[model samples]
Target: MLTYDVVVPVKLLAEAKTRLSPSLDRSARADLARAFVLDTIDAALAAERVAQVIVVGDLSGHVDEVPAGVVVVAEPEPRSLSAAIRHGIAEARRIAVDERVAGERAGRRSTRSHRGIAVLLGDLPALTPHALDAALGAASRHPLAFMPDAEATGTTLATAAAHTRFEPAFGADSAMLHRALGFHDLSHDVPAPLAERMRRDVDTIDALDAAVRLGLGAHTTAALAAREDRGAPGDHRTDAQPSSRPIDSTRKGAA
Candidate 1:
C-alpha cells in the first residue's frame, strides 16, 4: 500500500458556498461549509493510505473543532485556491522531511515511506475512507493522476509523486487543465466504487440532495438536520433554478 500526505484547502465559511444562498441563510451555509470540511478530514484520517492530513486555510474561529492528529496550517494571509493548495503541499513535504529526519536521528526504521501528496476537495461530504483509499491506490500507479468531479468538468482529487512538483490547477474546468498539464485521468481507468462517491462534491441543492441519498458523513448530516429543524427553505430541493445551470464562479474555488 502507498501512503499519501493529503492536503485539503478550505475557504473561510463566510465566503464559501454562495450558490446555496438561495435556499439557506448565511449562517446555515457557513455551518454546512464547516461540516463538509470536518467530514472530509474525518474520511481522510480513516483512509488506510493516508499518512498525514493537513488542512490549510483561515480557520481561526473553528480551530477547536479540528480533530486531534490533524495538522491545521492557518493562512491568515488570504490567497487564491491554488495558492492555498500549494501551501498545504509545502507543509506536507515539511512534515514528511521532519518524520524522516526524526527516524534517522533515533536510529529507528520507518514503517512507511511517504509516496507523495494528494489534494482532496473539502466539500465531499459523501467521501468515505474506503473510497479515498481506493482512489489513492489507483493514483499510486502514476506520477501524476487526477479524478474528475461528477460533472466531469472539474477536478475533485489530484496526486503527484514525492519527487514531482505538485502544481494544482484547481479552479473552473480544472479537470481539463490538469489533463492538459499531463496528469493522467484515473477515474475512467479505475472506475472503483469509492471513486464515484469521492467525485460527488456538493455545490448546489440538487447536489446536496444527491449526497444525502448517498448518505453523508456525520457532521454534514447533523448540519442539514439542524437546518431542517430551523425550517430552512428548499429542504434540500427547490425548483428555484435548473440543475443544469453552471456553478457560480465565486463558488468554484476551494472547498
Candidate 2:
C-alpha cells in the first residue's frame, strides 16, 4: 500500500570505503567497494514500494548499469552525501510538480505523483525484501519517519514529504537533529542480518570479512570468487565477528 520513490546516495567508490584501508590493500579495497555498492543498489531495486530508484551523482565508470527501472542522475554538484541527497529530492519533487502542472495545462486526467520520498544510504547488504516492505508500509501510515541505525546514532532510513524539512545534519547527533525537525523515530528489530547489512560496511577489514561470510552481492561475490581463484588457494571462510567500534547505543544523545 506504500507508494514512493527512494533516493539513494552513491558516491565515488575509490574515495569511499576508507575504513577498509587498515585491512586491505588498494585493489582489495576496490573489490570491497564494488561489493557494497552492488548489494545496496540491488536491495534498493528489489524494494516493492520503491517506484523509482534515483542515483543522484555522477558514478561514471564506477557503477555499472543501474538496475533496470532505476534512473541514474548526475548531481550537478558532487560535494557531500547531503548535497547529493538534496539534489535528488529536489529533482523528485520537480518531476512530480511537473506532472501535476502538465496535467493541469492539458486539462486532462491528473496523474498524481508520489506523495513523498525516502532517503536510504546505499550500503545495506543485509537488507531483505520483507524488511524493506515493512519499513515502507509503516512509513506510509506516518507523515514523517526516522529509522535509526543499529547503534541508533546514525540515520539509516528516513522518510519525509518532498517539502518536509529533512535537514541532513549528518555530522553527529543526527538522531536529535531529526527529532528537532519533528520527525518520529520508527525503530525496528535491527535484526542480525539487517544489523550486519546496516552495520559497518567495507570500511575496515572486519567489515569486509563480515560481508564475505554473509555472502556478498552478485558483483562482490564474483569479485571475491575471482580473488579466491587467484589467491594462494586457502579456505578463507570463518565466523565473521563484529568490529571494535560498535556505535555504543547508550552513548549521549548528541555525540
Candidate 3:
C-alpha cells in the first residue's frame, strides 16, 4: 500500500524555536520542542503508509524520550537541514540494502518491497494520522511530491520514490525550490481538513495558537497545560511582523 520510511530531522532543544523566545522562556521552548518531536513521531508511526521512522539529530541526552520502535540516528556534527536530511536518507538506503542482502544470503524469497522515503518536519504538532495517511497516499502517485506549508511558501513534507535520489532544497522559499526541481505539489490533492492541519507547521506564537485550536499532540498539550497551570500567559498574539518569513533554526547557536 505504498509504505515509506519517514525521516524527521530535529535540532537540539537548546537551539530550537528561537523565534518564539519573545513569548516563551528557554525551558518552555525546550519542552515545546521535545513535545513537537514526540507528537510528530507518534503521528508518523500511526500513519498506515509509514513503515519506519528515522529521527536524525543530536538527541544524545534525550533518546529515552522517543517512543519505542522508532530508529534514532545521531548527528555528531551539526550540519545544515539539507545535510541532515541527506544523512537520514542515506541511512534508510543502507538499511534497505542490508535487508535485501541478508534475504539473498538466507536463500529466502525477499518479501520486503522497496519503499519511498518521506521527509517530515518535526514541528507539526497538530499533525494527525489521517492527514499523514492521505498525504502519503496522494504522494505515492508521483515520482517526487511535496506539500507547501500553511503560508504556501515553505515546504512541510517531501517524498521521493523508491531508489530515486531526493535532492532536498529546504530553505527560504523551499516550496518554489522543490517545484523548480520537478517535485509535484500535492497540496491540493489531500482532503481539505488534512491539508489545513498538515500545513500548520508551528514556528511562531501565532502558529502555536492555531495548532492548539486544531488539537495538539499529547506532549505539546501537556506542556502548554503546565504553563497555564503556572499562571503563565497563553496568549499567542504577535505584534506587527511578517509571518511569511521562514524561521531557520539550523544556524549554529541561534538561541
Candidate 4:
C-alpha cells in the first residue's frame, strides 16, 4: 500500500531563488519563484501515493490560488526550511495518530506497512506527477529513501516519518546529512530516471535555462504557459513585490 503523505516547503520569493541573479534579473527571479511554488504543488497533487501535499510556509497570500487537490499550511513567522519540514513531520504524525486512534486509514498510515513521508523541495522545475509516483514506488520497498538533485551532491527529496529523526541541514552537504539520518541514499535510481523530465530545481539561472531548454514538468510547464497567456507587462507582474518577512514556523498543518 502507499505509505505516506507528501510535504513541500516553499520559500518566499524575495528570499528564495536569489542565486538565479546571475542569469535573471530580479523580476525574472520573482517570476521563477512564483512558477516554482505552483509547479511543486501541481506535481505533489498528481502523485498517486501522495495522500496530502502539505505546503508549509508563509504562502505570500497565494494560498487560495494553489492548484486544487493541494493543502496549504501557513507558518506565522520566518523559519528555516529545515524547521518548516520538521513542522510538516509533526503534522503528518498528528494525522497518523488521529487516524490510528479513530480507526486506521488503509494506506494513509499503516502501522504494518512501513510509514514514510516525502519532503519535496519547492523549486523543482523538471518535476512530474508520474516521476514522483515512481520514486515513491521505489521507496515503498525500503522504509527510507533519498532522491538527490541532478548533481547527486545535494538531496532534493527525502523520505522519513515523524519518528525517523530526519534532521535537515539545508545547505551544502545535504545529501550527507540525509544519509546520516538513515535515508536510502539512491543517487542514480530516482535522481537519474530518464523518463523523469521534471526533477531539476530552479536555484540558478543555469537551472532555469536548463528547464527552459529541456521542457518543463506539467505543473511548471502549465504555470509558465499560464503566465505567458496572462501576459505580464511592465507593471502588471504579480511577482514584482519583495518582502523580507520570513517563513513562519508555527504549526497550522491541518487539512
Q: Which candidate is the best by TM-score?
A: 1
- Model 2 regions lying over 4 Å from their true place: 62-64, 102-112, 189-202, 209-215, 232-255
Q: Which RMSD values do the candidates have, in order? A: 2.7, 4.8, 3.9, 7.4
**TM-score for candidate 1, residues paired by index:** 0.91
Report lDDT per candidate.
0.83, 0.62, 0.81, 0.63
Q: Which candidate model has the greater lDDT, 2 or 3?
A: 3
Each candidate structure's TM-score, on Cα atoms with residue i matched to residue i, is 0.91, 0.78, 0.89, 0.76
| Candidate structures ordered by TM-score, highest first | 1, 3, 2, 4
Clashes of 1: 0
**Which residue runs of candidate 3 sit more than 4 Å off their true CA positions?**
76-78, 111-113, 232-255
Q: Pairing residues by index, what is the TM-score of model 3?
A: 0.89
lDDT of 1 by residue, 36-121 (tens): 99999999999999988999985668878899999998763657797888889888887777887899899987643546899998
Q: Mind giving the per-residue lDDT tens digits that candidate 3 earns over 77-133?
A: 657687788888888888888888899999976544469999998999999999999
Whole-model lDDT for model 2 versus the true structure? 0.62
lDDT of 2 by residue, 1-255 (tens): 556777777666666655544444566655555566666777767778767777776456754555676777875663677778788788777777887899888987644454568887766655555566667676677778767665556676778754455555543667778778777776653344554454433434454566667666676667666766776332233236655543322221100
lDDT of 1: 0.83
Model 2 — TM-score against the truth? 0.78
Candidate 1 segments exceeding 4 Å error: 111-113, 233-251
